[model samples]
Target chain A: MKNIVIIGGGTGGTVVANRLANRLYDQKDISITLFAPEKNHIYQPDLLFLSLDLSDPRRMFRDEQKLLNKKVNLIQQPVDAINVDNKFVISKGKKYAYDYLVIATGARLVPDLIPGLAGNNNHFYDYSSAMQLRDKLRGFKKGVIVTGVADVPYKCPPAPLEFTLLLDYKLRKYGLRSSVDLTYIYPINSIFTIQNVVPILQKEYDTRNIAYKTFFIVDHVDPEKHEVVAMDGETVKYDLLVLIPPHRGQQIISDAGIGDEGGWMSVDKYTLQEKNHEEIYGIGDATNLPVSKAGSVAHFQSGVIANNISNSVLGIDEKINYDGSTMCMTEIGYDKGLILLFDYSHPPYGLIPSRLNHLAKVFYLDYYFANMMYGLP
Target chain B: MSDEKVTKVIDARGSYCPGPLMKLIENVRLAKVGDVLDLLSSDSGTKKDAPNWIKKTGQELIGIYDEEGYTRIRIKKIK
Candidate 1:
């Protein structure tokens, strides 16, 4: 039997596993397995809502095994090393052999990469940290509440903007809009990375009286001064700081010598396959695709990878490629959101933030489980 | 109408955003140079996105037509 192994049980890995299982079920010679370190599959986008007191933590996760196809042997263990040359993976002191490998290991937040940023953890990229930020936001009445990104290539490109706008609405709900001084800082010269979406947010921030400081790279945070020091010797004081930390792929990928210094695996942008190894496919945040490291991107890439791999397994010579299709739901607040979509060849059109988009996002909480994870059309 | 013969017809009526485009791309990759292609998509975004993709790839656009509950996009593989 040919073994198809998928690592990292996140969106891409799960979708690939499910799609492959569904497509190759009747084929007697093929078997599928998924290696996941975590028992729970998190709906990470909900972390945005969870941190703002807008969603329940209970809705954020599902058991990883339940989400997988029964045909897929779910091995809940952290992968220690990848022996690509020998075509095997080392997990829990045991090596598992595979005929094909899919890397959807995803990205990890390196909060401690920035000194003084890894405290009680005030970021929403993960579950516990989001809850911690939620409590802090709940207690604060008025003072400088700083929300910013520490680096580029972070997952969910629009999240910092989403959080800043949603925080404005949160303050408005608390009847402390005028009392709180909210500021958004970005490492880049612009407030956001995407040029097309920046104007809409710039106008929104101006209308909301939300101040933003650009080119403010974080140097360190001084708890005694209640301020964050920038690389340029500027300080911004804050009562509460929510920072999106620097992110990198799994270290095992780098240690295996198949990834970049940042640990992100290199792939042919169109094929989603490792540059030199066609047997290995990389998807999701782990890939160095010039696109947003969001779930929708993974959802789109899943189809390409799954289709191509299944085609190969079935002895078909035809193959398809991914076009960097990515769509992100930018929630301005509980009531307003917008959809940003683009591919490798197209830039995003102008955005119109609306409640309809917000409702779609709210609806997606259900749709994600019903369709996305199952790799359904 | 031009005398060029059709090369392939792809029905991607139920797929969501970029699915139809992806189908077109797959077929485009498979088609020989100068081959004619058509795609049927229910996703309205394809109406706008497909032409732009064709333009970027230097492929020839035949036309996009409306059909019963779907849109038809025609193209010719250039290079």
Candidate 2:
């Protein structure tokens, strides 16, 4: 019998576990197990809407145990370390051997990397932070609100932009738009990495009268002075600062000596197989792929990894490649949204902002919640 | 579509995508058989999703009328 153990039961891991169970169910010699530390599976995208009082926070999370297939074993324990050479994982003082290993432990947000950034600024990435920001916004009357990204490769690339747009709408609704000064500071030269969407976003920024600073790499924050210092010796002062901090991979990957300098697993861009280890594979934000670290990208990677793992077990030479296709449905506020689709070989094709796309984004969350309760799609 | 009187009218014009659909589904659950329900939604996804849901649940769809900025979806509870 062969044992397939997957770590991290987030979007990628959950989808991979379910799909693998469907493909290998009839085979008596294979067993599947998923290790996740959290009991609740969060629909992260809705956090943006939740902060803006547009969505219900209660609907954004569900019991993680209900999301997996009945055949898959679930061990809810934090991983202590992974012994790759020994082909085993140690969690909570117990070691489990695996014939095959799949790593889906997504990125970790490191706020402390930037000095004085954490506990001094507001961010709405996670559930608690979103709730905190909601309260802060409710009490906010008028001030200079600055939103910035400290580093790149953050999850949900369009999230910071969405927050700014939604904040603009919220402030206008509160009749404080004129009193507040809103600015977006991006590490890159453009508001978006995709060149095609720059003009469209820039036009919107101009129309909304929202100030934007490009090439502003945040080096540190001075809470007393209410300023953020850039690496190039530039500084921006603010009354309220919202920051997306630098992200890194799980510490266990580095502890196992299987990750790169940034602690992200090194995998083939097309095959998604670990570069040095054939028995291991990776998907989602945990891998050092040149793709946006978003849930949609992880969902797409789940398909490729599931197919490749199935072929490996069946002893078939056939392999399916992932084209690095990713799409982001961005909420541009005022009940409208836009879509940007791209792949490794092609540039992003931007769609005009419409109310339909906004509906689609909302529908996606509803479908995701329903699917999680019912099992595999 | 105007000849038949609507038993209930759901004013979900300003609500987001799944919000309108969820309201329609909730109201449908509380409605009796042959009860006609009207939903006004500005979200474009509900224009298609509501009809699809009605067909899936073995209900009757009267018609969808285009309004100024929103769509009016009419359905009957047959199941």
Candidate 3:
């Protein structure tokens, strides 16, 4: 009867919670408790569409309670702290001790890190901020709409490109298409991190005639002035701004001396187990993997993490290895998209495309609704 | 709908997560509002990913069949 505590009920956390629940279903002694902050679970990937008004924004989320399995206990409370040394999770002024723990808090987007980001206008990076930007984009009719990355390792590297394309479609439909000067700003040398999809996206940009401002690292945003200042002293003004903020790990990880220089959880590439603590396992954006922080990577790592945790609990040797598999879909427009697949072990394994590959993304959506949203095993 | 559409076709035999779902999305786009898009994927993670995506997109999932080669799912797009 071992107690397994999983923290954060997002992509990685939810998969681990459900997988463990099924593995220990017949065992009355193995208790699985999941701690998360909100009752509503937003499919973070859909934010790209939501920001651009391409899809029904209401479809982005459902009550978290509706998503989890019946066998697992759900705690809707912000984790105040994690006493890793003591092997307990502290949340909402309460603490639960566990024989084993899984850290899946993912990454935190810090708008405050950039100057003038949170001014009276609008900005976004994470869930709450993206929602705010969604509202702001609704009434916006024209002017410079500048979308840029504040820092590196932000979740879903292809998201910025998706936003740009969708915004192009939005403006064109609104008749103010010619009025809105849309510019996609990024610090990276290219539009996408995955090299193979770069050509596809560049074609989309050219077809849409969207402006591109590369190598402009946003240093700060001035809300009252309606402008974003770059680190190089160049300023880009905007009527509405969609910015991907700087990302960092949870405070608990940094406080516990378990994070890298960028405040990301440091873990071994082959084994997701913490580099410092063998008992601690991490998945999703929390890990300092040099890959794009997307949902597919988390799903791929969850299997590896679950296998290792199960073996450790049963005192059996673990045989799984984390290969850092991630897949991304770049939405070219309303009716068209591109699929990019990569094995991080191979470092940007270019783009391999087939008609079958596109179906995989659509099939994943149905799979999540039936198995995850409905609380099915 | 004939034997071609009825017989199971696991197109995602060697594909990954969004790869399978992206195909379904395109197929559904090609389909009329009531037409069905059937997909087969090898990734077990689809157990959670596929359904959640349908719920978000408002697509109707007709059925899901689990077989030896892969998992099959049928979805119909609703306007």
Candidate 4:
């Protein structure tokens, strides 16, 4: 039997596993196994809405076992290492052999990477941060609230912008807009990494009276002073500082000596296959692809890898490719939503935020987000 | 999908993601209301995203044909 071992229980891993199982439903000669460190899988995109006090915290997660197909064996264990040459993985000193391996160990928020930021990351990229941020927003009635992205190459480039916009919306609805001074901070000259997105965000920020500091890199956070120190000795004091901390790949990848300095595994851009290792593949934030490391990008690549692996197993000569597809559905407050879609060859230019886009973005969580674990697009 | 008259055939096989979708939209804007546009792409994301785009734009997605090496998506411009 052809054994397929997948690591991580996040969007990429769950989707890839279910998609592969659904693709090869009738095939009995293959066994698919997924390794996860958690019993419940959190829908990460919900964290954004969660921070804004928009979504039910309970609905943001589903049991990992319930999210997978019966065909996939779920092992809720921490993977210790990946033996590429031996075609096996070790977990708890136990060996699991595989004919093909999938690395979907998504990026982790390393708050300690930024000085004075550990235990002070009020930003909502994870569960605890979302909850803490929601609580903080409740008690916050005045003073400056700064939302920014501290590091580059973080997953979901639009999130920091989304947080700023959505927070503005929430404060307005709560009658606290006048009391709160909202500012956005970015390391680059533009508010967004994608050039086309800047004008749109800039227009919105201007209209909302949202101030921003461009080229202000975060040097450290001064919790005692409630201030954020920038690289150029500039300081921005805030009653509440919400920022996206730096991110890195899983430690196992680095320990295995298979990942880059940032712990991101290298892969063929088109095929999503691990470089120099034909039997291994990568998806989502763990990969060093130039694509945006959002769930939509992972969602798109999951199908490509699944289809390609299915074809490889069935002895079909067919091939499909991932084109660095990135779909970012971000809400720009006032019940408006922005949709950004681009690939390696083309950039999103004509797209704009609309009420329909906002509705669709929220609707995704109501239905598609949960159904997606079952391989639903 | 049908023996319908094809007003334009856009070969966007090597194009990625929104490339094919953008090409479809560009041609759709110029074509007559009844014109049918054929978009060919090897990128899988368009195969899924194009249908949503068509539905949102109130256009007709004729069908998605999985050809040997590429995908053929047919669209009808409706004003």
Interface RMSD of the candidates, in order:
14.3, 21.5, 15.1, 15.9
First chain of candidate 2, TM-score: 0.97
Better of 1 and 2 by lDDT: 1
User: Residue-wise lDDT of candidate 4 within B1-79, one digit each (tens)?
Assistant: 5888888776667655544654464355446889888888888877876786676556798888999888999999876
Q: List the residue pairs that clash in candidate 1.
A: none
Which residue pairs clash in candidate 4?
A: none
Worst 10 residues of 4 chain A by lDDT: A365-374
TM-score (C-alpha) between model 1 and the true structure: 0.81
Q: For residues A1-377, what per-residue lDDT tens digits would candidate 3 score against the true structure?
A: 68888889888888888777766667777888988887877777766665665556667677877777787899887777777788777776777888777889998866676767755334444555667777777777768888767666578877777777767877787787787888888764456555456687787788777777764656677777887886557788787777777777788887777875456777877788888777788888887655568877888887787777777776787569888677787666555666766674343443544445545543556566566644343
TM-score of each: 0.81, 0.81, 0.76, 0.81
| Better structure of 1 and 2 per DockQ | 1
Model 1, position A359: C-alpha lDDT score: 95
* Candidates 1 and 4, the one with greater lDDT: 4
User: What is the alpha-carbon lDDT of model 1 when measured against the actual structure?
Assistant: 0.82
Error of 1 at A51 (Å): 0.7
lDDT of 3 at A235: 80
Please report the candidate that would top DockQ against the real structure: 4
